[model samples]
Target: MMISRLSAIATAPMRNGLSSASMTSAYAELHCHSNYSFLEGASHPDELVARARDLEMPALAITDRNGFYGAVKFFGAAQRAGIQPIVGTELTIDDGTTPPKDRVDYDRWGERLLLLVEDKLGYTSLCRLISMAQMPNAKGVARLPADQLAPLSGHLTALVADPKERLPFYQEIFGRDRVFIELHDHLAPDDRSRNQRLLELAGRYAAPLVITNEVFYATPDRHKLHDVLTAIRHRTTLDEAQRYLHPNAEHYLKSGAELRRVFDRYPRDIV
Candidate 1:
């Protein structure tokens, strides 16, 4: 059923409400990863879709790190669950800045950006961009320089996360309406302050704000496995993963109502 639905959707010419803006669900999980993200994502695409179905979500995105490795699986699962599948990627752009040597896995190469396909054109552009980013670099290290994004910015919506300095740049490239400031709060001590700054930054460009939980797993119980994956990615033991591991089990797929409560202060950005 899943495969057939995906095949039919692929053969269809129209998007049929797959774009990010078309996601009318109370809350859309935009920044998500399945096990296709390698040592970082803890759950499979079907598992993630199952959770989204249980939570009554209408749409779910699989923005696996740097690629669409699980897009087929995600699309199939989502379609079978009667959910729209939004295709995207968590692209790491090289800013020509060095990260702290102490940091092992996260952000060691460059900045992270979310690019969602708005149409067939965007999907084509995304494929070209990912190929360019991966082909020139080492096998596992994928990074596209910041300057390379503008030409391929057409038909794609951009979402800026972390290191607010590049938010304005993306806004300029993708245009104010096409770019959004992503606000993620995982109950960390700095979440409030960081999100406050992000709000201020978005205000400067008149860019819209979107709430994303940055889900890496389908349920809270998978957090332990997530920790182990993080440890493996960093080539360290769980005991040594200390600061590298997420402080809480909050990076799991959340329901619309739960997301509403989490971002109650910013009710307007829930969707």
Candidate 2:
């Protein structure tokens, strides 16, 4: 049974709409963070790529927040490891209707959207979108309105995590086939309920579901550092930032077998 299961994992086709020419793994990590996400990410691009390669993952994405700061480094590492490199970003979109208290409040002003590039056209669109968000904002504050997506939605795939009301807009802009409902399970108490809600939304909209660990660090042992980084980002002590930190150490670069086990009931969502 073990051998058969592993074989199935090795041979299963990727269903996340990404090309699998050089990426043969059954599972590919689509949502990831590196140290370039500022204080929010705990691992370097090289370290993340090495961890993914060691786990036998055929491809890994560096979806750092707001920018592709670590993309060049990640691509280099993936090339050396002989794996496909997926470039994307966790874009924060604010409709510009509300005024934030301050420039630093950009983080609190917007909803986050995960975008993955599908081809050269997607890469060009991502660059333009990032520029549109950053050019008019303060140095560290970057957010774009939803109106910016329509022109750039052609070659990109979107993964929606929250604010279910925005899913329909994404479907309209990116097409239902390009918009996916993202599921993340950090093993927290609320994970089950949140994922259940997302599942229901997917069913209602007939959207595909994709599961990601939203990895911050390369391994479970790095959780402490991740916690420290979270505290730093919030400008608070560990005790004070407990509410913002991850509830457990499950956000690591998991292998195909480990991911299958984590989402066992929804195994088809691993892609």
Candidate 1 structure quality by residue, lDDT tens digits, 1-271: 1111221232111121112332234566888989999888999999999998988776778999889999988888888899988899999888787644444465366888888887788898999899988998766777798899899998887777674577777878887666767777888888878877776666566766666789999999999999999888788899998878889999999875565566655435432
Error of 1 at 217 (Å): 0.2
Candidate 2 structure quality by residue, lDDT tens digits, 1-271: 0011111223222244212221334576778999999887789999999998887786778999889999999999998997778889999888545646544433456788988887788888998999998898778877888888898888887888895588889999998777877777777888878887877777788776666778889999999999998877767799998988888899987765676565554434432
RMSD of each: 6.1, 6.1
Question: Roughly what TM-score does model 2 have, to 2 decimal places?
Answer: 0.86
Q: For each candidate, how many residue pairs have backbone atoms clashing (under 3 Å)? A: 0, 0
TM-scores, all candidates, are 0.86, 0.86
The lDDT per prediction is 0.76, 0.76
Alpha carbon lDDT at 181, candidate 1: 71
